[model samples]
Target: MRVTIVMAALAVLATAAFAQDSPSADNGKVVFDKWCTPCHGAVAPPEMPFGGDGLPGTSALGVKYRGELPAVLEERTDLAPEFIETVVRGGLFGMPITRKTEVSESELEDVIAYLTRNNN
Candidate 1:
């Protein structure tokens, strides 16, 4: 079990190492708007009040939640970048992993930056 954890951590570090190498925030922005924007918004179910106006390709969660559905993530300011990347790569039960193909490395970083911004 310990070895598994270490291996996973190493793998995550490697991926993040490469992610840091990606130097295109513009590409990241595009990737975010396309994929991450659907479920990682700031509003909740009742507040934003999704009117069920989903067209094709829209996420089912988006219909019920906001674009920033993972509200708790916003609160975790001290969280590790690698942890966030892993969660995004291998999604939670309610969330789907945003594959590298779906979003470029820079794009993922940009989305993380955008989400972590202190707009509040």
Candidate 2:
């Protein structure tokens, strides 16, 4: 009985360690919603106080890809973690660069994990 109890405890500890090593999509979703959703969401209500603008990034991507790829980043399968990190940090065209203050390193990793969750 004591041996069995010791094995159970070890199993629990192992599971906890594995979980910490993995990136969380839920946390990534929160980061994406807070930062990228404003410009990249599929839809934005026109009733918003910020003038109800449509998704600029989505629109631009649609025009650029011409339906060959998904306009929404999350729906896209061709994205690489490196590309996402570069664009987020360096900005592209009309997009503004995200500073470390706005997005920490760990938060960026979460966002990358969230966006690339389907790649695997």
Candidate 3:
């Protein structure tokens, strides 16, 4: 009986440890710095607004969206997660493909968590 109880306690501890751990904003930040910052910069726009006028480069959607991402995403949550996943995987219009080939499915989930932040 004592051995069984000890095993049950170990199982409970293991479950708690695993449940408390999850990939979140910090992991998303690393992915963003590598994949996004070159295009979008650190903060979203209206705060740091700029178009290609200053720099002879990309069309900087940060400035284009102008803080509208939260609203748009909130309004359009009816679209399935797969749709967003496909868009992220393929890239859109002139944007380059966002994900490195090595990124796993779970990392994509982390990115989604970052995008649909609690602000909305």
Candidate 4:
């Protein structure tokens, strides 16, 4: 009886750990829309005299990957949470690093969940 109780407790702890790591994609979508949509969105208005100033990130990614990968990060099938966190924190190329004050850890987790929802 004692062994069974201990096993159940361990299982519950493990489940909680997993739950904390997954986060909520819905919340993540909100974060992405607020913080990332300006550059990474699929559509943008053509306000510039030369061309549209929207989807810059998408355009850059398209040129960088040469059509081999999707320009949208959210559409990609290969994105790890750790990779997302690192990029957001450290920045890449023209992208600026996000400060913890600008984006809390919890918000970052939500963004990761939204961007990587298609991975699974």
Candidate 5:
């Protein structure tokens, strides 16, 4: 029927729209560089003391994980979207909570996309 055909067309259009609106990992990298890179970036040296030099968060995580996980945020593959969301909204250990004004919900979604890009 014509109605069935129209419904299928509409569904296809809706899927296309959703795909376009989905979070972009590329954009997420920009957001992460702006907000998270200062603390979680790989700029810090391995010998850098925690809180004494570059990338305190990286240093702390390095010490905490002790090679079990990646200290650099971008290289991490074990991060879950839900866990990232929770940590971003609620302060985790030394990492402070990220406010919506600072990093919008859309940006947060993008960040999650970027961080989880390597996830299988």
Candidate 6:
């Protein structure tokens, strides 16, 4: 167990080092489309209240934010890098934790860049 923990820590450190490279928001959009769009996609006008029958994340956020914030992930501009990193890595409410294998540290960094591109 100790060895496993140490190995995991080292792997995280290594990935952190690799994530330092400049991330591309364009590439992040691709990753987001592939991985996050299914649950977090835009809701049509007809689906405004519930996000249709497929977009649970969007619908949930719609209910959670009550219009104070955009439910569509792409439209949100208040995301912070640290918050994104924590939520993506540890999950939040109904969102599942994304493993490094699923979205490598580099990919996560890129996603952050893409999501925060419109931030002030």
Task: Give the winner by TM-score.
Answer: 2
Model 4 per-residue lDDT at 85: 93
lDDT of each: 0.59, 0.87, 0.54, 0.85, 0.89, 0.88
Model 6 CA deviation exceeding 4 Å by range: 1-20, 43-53
Clashing pairs in 5: none
Best by lDDT: 5
Q: Count the clashes in each prediction.
A: 7, 0, 0, 0, 0, 0
Q: What does the lDDT come to for candidate 4? A: 0.85
| Candidate 3: RMSD to truth | 5.7
Cα lDDT for residue 18, model 5? 90
Which candidate, 1 or 4, has the higher lDDT?
Answer: 4
Model 6 Cα shift for residue 26 (angstroms): 0.3
Candidate 3 wrong stretches, greater than 4 Å: 1-21, 43-59, 66-84, 98-100
Per-residue lDDT tens digits for candidate 1, residues 47-69, read 32345332212335454446555
TM-score for candidate 3, please give it: 0.53
Instruction: Estimate, for each residue in 35-76, the C-alpha lDDT of model 2 and write its tens digit.
Output: 999889877556435433478888778778989999888898
Q: Which stretches of candidate 2 lie over 4 Å from their true place?
A: 45-53
Q: Rank the candidates by lDDT, best first.
A: 5, 6, 2, 4, 1, 3
Evaluated against the true structure, the overall lDDT of model 1 is 0.59
- Higher-TM-score candidate of 3 and 4: 4
Model 1 quality (TM-score)? 0.45
Please, what's the RMSD in Å of model 4?
A: 3.6
Pairs of residues at least 3 apart in sequence or in different chains that clash in candidate 6: none
lDDT of 5 by residue, 7-115 (tens): 9999999999997789989999999999998898988655644344577778888778988999998899889999999999998987888899999999999999999
Task: List pairs with backbone clashes in candidate 2.
Answer: none
Q: Candidate 5, after superposition: displacement of residue 21 in Å?
A: 2.0
